[model samples]
Target: MTYRGRFAPTPSGDLHRGSLLTAVASYLDARQADGAWHLRIDDIDPPREVPGAADRIQQQLAAHALHWDGSVQYQSQRHDAYAAAVDMLLASGHAFYCALSRRQLADLGGRHPGPAVAVSPASHSATNTNPNPNTDCAIRLAVPDTPICFTDRLQGRQCLSLGEADGAFVIRRRDKLYAYQLACALDDADQGMTHILRGADLMDSTLRQVHVLDCLGRTRPDYGHLPVLTDSDGNKLSKSAGAAALSPDTSANLYGALRLLALDPPADLAGAPCAEQLAWAIPQWQPARLNNTLTFGVADAP
Candidate 1:
């Protein structure tokens, strides 16, 4: 338990500014803590993954000098592992198949995929409403009645009952794809990741992941959800918003990412070499100094 950490990025596009900021922060945090950091490419969904995007992502990480200690972990090669996880959950009785379609489930409970809106007194923790025999539904974890709570290194002392966050969402989709909740939880545990640093957009998802960990009899890890990278109009940084992709060839690109993470670069080395700048940044990095706001930028990452 030497402060293991990881940065798992989806290879749907080039490394936009937001992603760069996350990697730099995670890299510096691990280096500063004198811990090991691992990189895991979340390329489970092949259709959504862009061609050559994964290679480009690694190229960009190299450009940023955000080197990981061990061999990279790719989710694409882990389907058999995911299958084993799914089978294990099914056998343990902690997970079950649900035939409730989007429409039927939403009609009864506001929105099918939204945060737990109105807790059903009748259905809360009751196994009777488990998917009816006729309908085809996704597998959902049976979250306990107790609140799923954790202390975020940045946000701090958060709490939410299992039903409060998407009331029993799918771990295995109807399309047979692994839900991010189950996959990420299992991967984090398998890799011994004690510190998770990522975007604030995943804050809600963390609740479900925690429940999955509990169901698997695993302990939750420390977390730091950085603010969303947004556009000038205040939209979160994304391809839809047209954020600038990281320029691997551009000078001082990594420094800009560090600045976004709120790590103060030493003034003398403001224009110092990448290694030197990173050397200064790692020691100054602290998760508590970050903001939890849903960040957005107009054109580039801020």
Candidate 2:
């Protein structure tokens, strides 16, 4: 299989130092393997999306010289594909309509119905037999009771039971918008992505996507998670947390990102051009240098 990888960013805000770190690491990994690196703008959730964030993200990447292969993919335009996958899962008995509201589920016990809350085909409401685009209930995958396990390249072995962790998780919302898990899983598999290297914060969502792929009978991708960059206060750097956006004018930020990855970039490369810095760092990319640490603080950058 071709070593295809991707950097998928949700366009809720501009790329921050933390996000730029992810982009750098992902780009290096794909380049080292002589693979194709793809960029995907995850803008499916309109309620959370910024008006011009998607285009700004592309410009930011271009400014950093982190060019991607092929035309950029936008999740907002893939509704038809998502709907078809949901329909297939429904028809094949892999997913079901869940009319239980959050309050209702919580009333059952917890905010989510645990492993014991498996819904049977006979339990489906009359409308479940033929749900339409206007269906009001959420669509959830009927996850198996077994634990989903996979070894991460950095975080090591991971095993989590989907049913116990999140129960029958939602793939489509009540408002007709497709859930992130569904679209993400489908896109990775459909795009022929063979390897995925992303932040540790998203590690938990991997199994959910794995299960989704299994239900759709698609090939699973190899997964790895880089350590998440935290702020001085130890909180994860995020747009919601008001993390500073990246400035592409200087390669100092890129060099700092390399150090954050534990690459220990040469002193001469500190203020060098982005292309020159990348030329030296690409072959020297060592993901294992993170030493399985889960968080890197802004203050810790040298």
Identify the leading candidate in terms of lDDT. 2
Query: What ranges in model 2 sit over 4 Å off?
Result: 111-135
38-87 in candidate 1: lDDT tens per residue? 99999877777889988988877876667887899998887887888878
Q: State the displacement of the C-alpha of residue 158, model 1, in Å, after optimal TM-score superposition.
A: 1.0
User: Model 1, poorest ten-residue lDDT window?
Assistant: 111-120
Q: Local error of candidate 1 at 108, Å? A: 1.7
Best by TM-score: 2
> How well does candidate 1 match the true structure in TM-score terms?
0.86
Q: What TM-score does prediction 2 earn?
A: 0.92
Candidate 2 weakest lDDT stretch, 10 residues:
119-128
Alpha-carbon RMSD, each predicted model: 4.7, 3.4
RMSD versus native structure for model 2? 3.4
Candidate 2's residue-wise lDDT over 111-153, tens digit each? 3443234333334322224333344578888778789989998
